[model samples]
Target: SKMFYGGVKPEMVSDKFSFTEGPSTDKEGNVYFTDQPNDKIYYWDWKTNKVIEFLNKTGRANGTHFDKDDFLITCSDDQGEIWKISKDKKVEVLFKGFEGKRLNGPNDVWNDSFGGMYFTDPLYERDYWVDFKQETP
Candidate 1:
């Protein structure tokens, strides 16, 4: 279903990557999206119409969000880790294995006002990956 607007034409952004997910935005209206299968973060500068890769080897980063301090919080699928990336490119591992058990691969996540994180775990079978046969958290 397509909605029509008066006197407005739809424009498309240039394609740079595939498997786009984890769409988020900063205070300046710049859009951020992830290429999950490629393990990369991409940024679209709204002002200049430029797209760029923010990070590589991003732990197969999937879902992402901006924290209150504007840091990028991402669920890294490859290492099953949660990462907090500061503006100056400092990477912090917020969480790895829960109770000494590897997660089912954190699929999505969010942070509370007090910086508490709530994430989801779902079993995802990959070509080179094994089952996460651990107790659920």
Candidate 2:
């Protein structure tokens, strides 16, 4: 098979985390994942073969995807919003809500071929949202 990640088997980088989700890979083969319970995001560097903590205080980010600009887009569910993050660790809230109502909780995100985005808003409660309430149906 000369096509497609030929025989690329899943490799376990580590088993240290409270809870983990949202694994996204960059063009450079670096893998980024989230640990919501710990409010942290980690990345596995292809060059170094190491799992490095990329950021903390992640807003309980659940799912992540890379945008056309190579920005790491994440569903910052703790705020019921989406975030666009740069390589330098700069963050910007891209979307908050729709129709004047708060989102349920953006759990995942995916980018279209044309640079548009698609995401999932599921009602996944978090410990951080102390006064939490689902504003929309």
Candidate 3:
């Protein structure tokens, strides 16, 4: 048998959200993604083939990844924090800031086999901010 479904075509899953970003998958093949403008996270269940709201009021998360322990790690850009959401829907702040300064914004993340995580921080001025500049670090 072929390892992939060669004849499959791309299909639009959902169009109800504003903007989607940071899609990741768990060990069970369930796909998770975030809608940054709407502050929500959604999931595509592998068994049911349905897209459902996994989390709301998600701190304007832009990027996400599933850690080894099955926790949903998210870049909560609204507050410049990294969050971890568990299976039971509990949220925890994994990272807050650096040297008393707020992070620019976490854009994406990846986890290594050794339980280390790496992410990108980029500065982007948002409408909600009072006085912020986009700068390179």
lDDT of 2 at 129: 84
Provide the global lDDT of candidate 1 against the true structure. 0.79
lDDT value, candidate 2, whole model: 0.89
Runs with alpha carbons beyond 4 Å of true place in candidate 2: 1-9
- Give the true-structure RMSD of model 2: 2.4
Q: In model 2, which residue pairs have backbone atoms overlapping below 3 Å?
A: none
Residues 22-43, model 3: lDDT tens digits: 9999999999999888889999
Worst 10 residues of 1 by lDDT: 128-137
Sliding window of 10 residues with minimal summed lDDT for model 2: 1-10
What TM-score does each of the candidates earn?
0.84, 0.90, 0.89
Residue 43, candidate 3: alpha-carbon lDDT: 96
Q: Candidate 1, residues 27-67: lDDT per residue as tens digits?
A: 78788878987888888898998887888878888888888
Which pairs of residues collide in candidate 1? none
> In candidate 3, which residue ranges exceed 4 Å CA deviation?
1-4, 130-136
lDDT of each: 0.79, 0.89, 0.86
